[model samples]
Target: MAGLFRRTMDYLYLACVVVGTTALVLISAVIPYAVFTRYVLNSAASWPEPLAILLTIVLTFIGAAAAYRLNLHMNVAYFANKLPPAGRRLLDLLVQLLMAVIALFMIIWGERLVEVTWHNTIADFPFLSVGITYLPIPIGGFCLLLFIIERIFLGLPPDPITHGSEAPSFD
Candidate 1:
């Protein structure tokens, strides 16, 4: 059962990474197109602005989720390495819990925002709805939330690479 759970989580994490990568590529392509159309052709690409905005939001969250699963958040661990094992574990748990709380809040607030945007439409891209723009927030929030929960179960260190760290390597 534990193996199954880990595999599932890994699969989800991989999916988020693939999606995020695709979004990044799309953003790069669209932004250049938008710029080229506006300057060279004297007209903006109507879809690029909204698409880029939405893609960026998605990429941010997805990247965050990937980072969380891999325990790749930015932090200095050189000092934490001097601490005793218990102290390190305590600090690790605290950091993980704090991140979990933040993800929870994002999920809650993002859902509300999604609901509000669902009914409306975007100004520049009339064919596309606002819900599409808002979708990334909740989706990323939920993915981050899942990774956070899994991290809690995995008992991750605040900084796994801290000085003299002997913890098993992962991710």
Candidate 2:
């Protein structure tokens, strides 16, 4: 059952990556086209700037979730590196819990923001709402919280190299 859950998470992370990449590409293309039209053709794409900003925000949040799944976030390990293996494990658990708490905070605050913006719409973008623009924060925080919880349940340790052990001699 645990293995199945892990596999499902892996697939979800992969899907997030694929979707975020596609959105990034589309945003890049659209923004550039808009710029070109405005400068060269004396025409403007009214929605490009707003849409590009929205796409960028969504891509960032989704990409962050993918990174969380991959355990690619940065950490301050200079002190933890000096600890023994068991100590290292404890420290990792502590950090994971802290991260989960922080994520929860973001989720709560983000939801509040969304609620406040629920009745508001973006002035520059007619089709998009403020809620849509602010939705990614809570979603990303939720993903991050889940990832950290999984790590805690799986007893994941910080990277071994985070200990700053010397590399094996090549000679």
Candidate 3:
């Protein structure tokens, strides 16, 4: 059962990485095109800007979940690291609990936001529903919640080695 759960989470994390990367690439391409069309061609495109904004939202939320799972999210580890091993473990558990709460809030409010905006259409793209743009919020929240649960129960994955000057190797 544990193996099955871990495998499932691994797949989900991979999916998040793929989706986040695709959104990031699309946003990068769209923004430059929007800028070029507006400034270089002297004809501003309406859809690109809004599309890029939506993609950014997707990238941010989805990427955040992946980062959290990988333990790559920004955190202040100074105080926690200074503590003894048991204390550090307790602190880590506490932090995970807090993250779970935040994820729950996102899931609840994000769905509400989607419901409220479901009937509204995007200004730039009349065919696209505004609620569709907000889908990432709840989806990402759910991903984050799953990761939090996995970490709390299964323990964290091993840390990857860093070779850069910013993260020097002690060994």
The best candidate in terms of TM-score: 3
Tens digit of lDDT per residue, candidate 2, span 1-171?
767766666676777788689879989899889989899989887888878888888898878877776677666789999999999999888888888888998799999998999878888875667987888889888877877777778644334343335666558
Model 1: per-residue lDDT, tens digit, 94-162? Answer: 887897888888888888988888878878878777877777777777888777777778644244345
Give the TM-scores of the predictions, in the order they appear. Answer: 0.84, 0.81, 0.91
Regions more than 4 Å wrong, model 1: 155-171
Range of the 10 consecutive residues with the lowest summed lDDT in candidate 3: 157-166
Clashing pairs in 3: none
Q: State the lDDT at 74 in candidate 1.
A: 82
The positional error of residue 136 in candidate 3, measured at the CA in angstroms, is 0.7
Q: Could you arrange the candidates by TM-score from highest to lowest?
A: 3, 1, 2
Residue 13 displacement (Å), model 2: 1.1
Q: Which residues of candidate 2, in runs, are more than 4 Å off?
A: 155-171
- Residue 6 displacement in candidate 1 (angstroms): 0.5
Listed per candidate, the RMSD to the true structure in angstroms reads 5.4, 5.2, 3.6
What is the number of backbone collisions in each predicted candidate, taken in the order shown? 0, 0, 0
- True-structure RMSD for candidate 2: 5.2
Model 2 per-residue lDDT at 125: 73
Q: Write the per-residue lDDT of candidate 3 for residues 115-155, one digit (tens) a residue.
A: 99999998888998999899999999999999999999998
